[model samples]
Target: MSTIFRASRPAFRARTFFQQNASKTTRRFQSTESTTANAAPESWMQRFWKSEKGPKTVHFWAPMMKWGLVLVGVSDFARPAESLSLTQNAALTTTGIIWTRWCLIIKPKNYLLAAVNFFLGCVGVIQCSRIFMHHQAQKKLAEEVSEAKEAVKEAKDAIKHKSS
Candidate 1:
């Protein structure tokens, strides 16, 4: 009976450890800091709560824009006539201008490299209207979300005032 109890105790501890550590989602979601003794923290829901500047959003946007420019440049280089049109060229130029302005604003030490990338990124943004459009949509969505939240808080305050 004593030997059987000892074997069961180790198995129970191993099972508990495995259950605590294993998750199929993001590592941030599985972190110990986010959890409690009674229940796991709602890490997934916490993603929506933007208390401050988030690194994930910034990281995602920069890389996505950079890669988008790369794809546009490659496509434009390969087949300018088919892959890009007059409107696309204009867009690319506009994008380049924006990027150059940003680079100047940041004042990177590697000015030459930054300038080249800025121009290249502009071309890509112009070439791929889809990417640009998507970015615009996302920007709009974020703005709308902020506005809506503010409106809701204002409405709540108005209700409280009336009730008082």
Candidate 2:
């Protein structure tokens, strides 16, 4: 039995990690096209967005991690102090479940800590996406602007030659 359990533990963890990573990769690839949908051809934004993998992973894993942290937060707040009976621990667990589900559902904002955490999680997702998009857009704009300047310089040189 011990051998069976020991052999299974690593397998289980590996399976879980792969499952999580697979989903994360799927989300990133799916979102990459949309992230630069507005980018112009040959623009730095297009090239930059085309090369990234971060946005997709965040798109996939942010929700899962938020929920995990919620559970952890609940556990920390509900754990009984020293000298507590087993019954107290059970009761606290039940209470924590109820509170967690409730905050997730009805009165979320009433629990300030949970609310803040939730908001931060959402903001983090949006910020990550926005930052990537912004960088892409900036790169595109810079490249376009530089190209335009070069074109203008060439046109001016052509005019000078014609006048000479």
Score each candidate by Cα lDDT. 0.60, 0.53
Q: Could you give candidate 1's per-residue lDDT for residues 38-114 as a string of tens digits?
A: 67565854764542223345423464556566665766655634334656566666666666666556632334435
User: What lDDT tens digits, residue by residue, belong to model 2 across residues 13-70?
Assistant: 4567677888778765465457567765577755545543223444324445556644
Off by over 4 Å in 1: 1-60, 80-83, 106-164
Candidate 1 weakest ten by summed lDDT = 51-60
How many residue pairs clash (N, CA or C atoms closer than 3 angstroms) in each of the candidate models, in the order given? Answer: 4, 4
For each candidate in turn, the TM-score is: 0.30, 0.30
Report the alpha-carbon TM-score of model 1 versus the true structure: 0.30
Candidate with top lDDT is: 1
